[model samples]
Target: MKRIAIIGAGASGLTAACYASGDGRHVLLFEKQKKIGRKLLVTGNGRCNISNRNIIAGHYHGHNSRFVDAVFSRFSLQDTITFFEELGVPFIEEDEGRLYPASLQASTITKVFQYELKKRNVDLQLHRRIERIEYEETGFTLYTAGAEEHRVDSVILAAGSCAFPPAGASNIGYDLARSLGHRVYEPWPVILPVTIPLKSLHQLQGIKWDAAIRVEVNGKEQERSVGELLFTAYGISGPVSLNVSRSVNAAVIAGKSPVVIIDLYPSMSGDDLARRLDRLWSDGGKKTGFSLLGIMKERMPEVLCGIAGVDPEKRVASLTPADKEKIAGTMKNLILEPGKPRGFQEAVAAAGGVDVDEIDPATMESKLVRNLYITGELLDVDGDSGGYNLQFAWSTGAIAGMAQ
Candidate 1:
């Protein structure tokens, strides 16, 4: 039997091992951490969003994002669902087609993989980190910490990116790829909160509102996201903020300022919002400007009124047409300049990795090295939030595993 070594034991590593084993091949899965799937266990806030039903190449980003098409064509989303189902982990769909295990626990997926791996008698070496790899014409020799070496016929580098360091995320995968003559794009954190650092917004910390967020760099619109917007002491968070953070971070990294324009009422047009404010003011018998805008959360009206140059304590009936227009405009377009995105410690995924042009997407094997496969976030491709990243991981891992 040929000995195949798989590194990282993460979402991709585990999936690859499960697929690559038991075909007259002995798979050795190595993990740096004491336990397997540490990062996987914390995904989706511990729910383990396995994949998204709405898988599309457009949802992914990279220098050559089209590379994902070949991989996904080989192992589609339906194949992922069926593979998990056969492993006794049926999925349940949530909002946005986010698929989770029926148990709704990340531990369930890990445990099921553990059971299957054991049944297949694959060698799972936890706490064994492969420090370096030496490839020869005969085969490959892997060097772990303390210079312990093992020989294998094929190697799979499924070690993930440095997104969540607490879960053993590191740059080892990138380092390994580079040593093997692959070009690695500088990695940056994505899917994290942005730090606006505006004192006016800080006062509204802990407030959660469903709004639309648009990221603009140098007066040009870049990207937009619509969902829950959360206020934090440092800046903005929540799904909407996280979704657009990639663009914000990219602008900041390029030394350009990124402004986050929020639409408090995305469902309403400017005219609609102006009309609603008119009705509220007209109906206010003796309420202050603050009290008239009771549709907003507490303390929010004061901020909006302050921005509009209207006194919160002033009677709504006394507000002029100009004052109402300013208020309406402020409500429709709340501009905030964000500083930098939170670091990798808080990011859900990273933005860059080994350049996709160096890998064969159909097989996920490195073009520079034969029988060497790369998978998961280690590749340059990263997907939008809402289970897209995990879907890419599953597709790439499955393709790499099944590759001869």
Candidate 2:
């Protein structure tokens, strides 16, 4: 019987093991951590967003789109649902097509994958950190840092990227790929909180609102996201902040500093906001300038007043047209100079990995090394903060599992 070796036991690694072990191949899955799915357990804040209801090629970002396009064409979002359903794992869809397990537990997803691997008779070896990978005419050989070694007919590299190192996310995949004569794009942090230049901004910590955020690099607007914006002592966070983190990290990686712009009132135009303030002043002439925008958190109005150069203690009736416009402009565009990303420790994912061009998109097999398959975050592709990244893992993993 032909033997197969799969590195890592995360989402894609486990999925690949489940499929590749089905035909009774001597499958062995190696995990660097003490147990499998440590990172999976923390996905979706432990609710385990399994997949997205609507997944498309546009949701993914990488050096090449053809790779994701080809893989999705084979194993689609529907196929992912069917596969999980067959494993007795049901799903529920929320706003924006985010799919969570019916039980709302990320552990459920890991349990089901573990059950499937056990049912398939897969040999799951934990705490086996692969130190090196060598290819030969017959197949491949793997050496663990502990001095244990194994030879197999085919090898699957699903070791994942080094994003959350504390949670056991490692870069063995890239190291192995590079050792085997494949190019690796330097990996950087993504989907993480960003640091801002406003040291006094910590005064607004714990304040959150629905706002529109735009990231500009080198004076050019790159991407914009509209969702909840969170203020912290470090900088900003929340769905909107995380959504645009990839573009921010990409810009910084390219040696450009990014400026983050927040629109506190996304639903209102500047003129409309100014008019609203005018009405507020008309009705509450004796009120302080800070009290005019009291519809938000008590701390926010004062902060905005300070940022807009308006005296918080001044009476609203004493405000001039320029003062109202200034307030409106600051409310519409709360610009901040951003520093580096929070790094891999706080990152939800990494932005770079083994170059996609070195692998066959359809099969996920290394073009430079035969019988070597790569999948998951180990590849250059990464998606937005939602379930898109998990879908990429499933799609590429399923294709690589069935490769001959």
Candidate topping lDDT: 1
Instruction: Please provide, for model 2 over 181-262, each residue's C-alpha lDDT reduced to its tens digit, 9 standing for 90 to 100.
Output: 9888888888888788686676789998999999997779999999888899898998899999888877777788788999
Candidate 1's residue-wise lDDT over 23-82, tens digit each?
689999999999899988988889998888899898889999678888888999999999
Instruction: Point out where model 1 deviates above 4 Å.
Output: 283-289
RMSD of each: 1.7, 1.6
Write down the worst ten-residue block by lDDT for model 1: 284-293
TM-score of 1: 0.96
The lDDT of each candidate is 0.88, 0.86
